[model samples]
Target: MVVAEIAEALDVRTWQLQEAKDQLSEVIETAQVRGPQMITRHGRPRAVLLSAEEYLAMTSDRPDFKEWLLGGPKANLALPESAFKATGEAKVEK
Candidate 1:
C-alpha cells in the first residue's frame, strides 16, 4: 500500500517523519522500487532515501577532488615578478 502519492513534477514521494517511522520497511521497499523517497519533518524536507543501486549510480562515475585537479588542462601562463613577492611580515630561517 502506498503511504503517499508521488509528486509527479519531481518524481519523488514525500512522507512525514512520523509516517515514515511508522512504516519504515514499506518506505525502504518503495525506495528500492521507486526512485527516491523524501522524508520531511514538520512539513519541511529533512532527508531522502535512495536504493543502493541509485546511490551507487549517482556517485560511482564522479572523480575525487585529487583526480579532478590532476585531470584539468595544463596552463603555461607567466606572471610578473611582483606576483611572487612575500606580502607577510614573517622571516624564514635556514
Candidate 2:
C-alpha cells in the first residue's frame, strides 16, 4: 500500500470573504480585532479567518469527554470496603 498527499489550500466558506491583504505581522492582529474574519473573492463568499489557537482547537481531535468519564465499564458496583466500614448509623458526635 502507498499513501500520498498533494499540497492543497484550505477552503473556508462564509457569506463573503475579502482577500487578505496585509503583512504577516498584521494578520494575527487583524483577526483578533475583527473577531473571526470573512473571506470573499470578487463578490461571493469563500472562507473565514481564525486565530491560530481557535483553528487548532477546532480542527484537532477532541476526546469524547463525557464518554471518557464513563469509558472503562458500567455495572452495578458497590463502594469500597473502607466506605462500608463507616456503618449504617452515624457516629454519635461527642
Point to the candidate with the largest lDDT. 1
lDDT of 2 at 43: 56
Off by over 4 Å in 1: 1-6, 79-94
lDDT of 2: 0.52
Which residue pairs in candidate 2 have backbone atoms (N, alpha carbon, C) closer than 3 angstroms, thus clashing? 12-47, 17-39, 17-40, 18-39, 18-40
Tens-digit lDDT track of model 1 for 1-94? 2334435556888989999999999999999998799998877778899999999999998999999999999997865455556554344334
Whole-model Cα lDDT per candidate? Answer: 0.82, 0.52
Report how far residue 40 has shifted in candidate 1, in Å: 0.5
Question: Which digits, one per residue and each the tens of the lDDT, describe model 2 over residues 16-80?
Answer: 32236544445556666654555556654455668887888787886688877777677767555
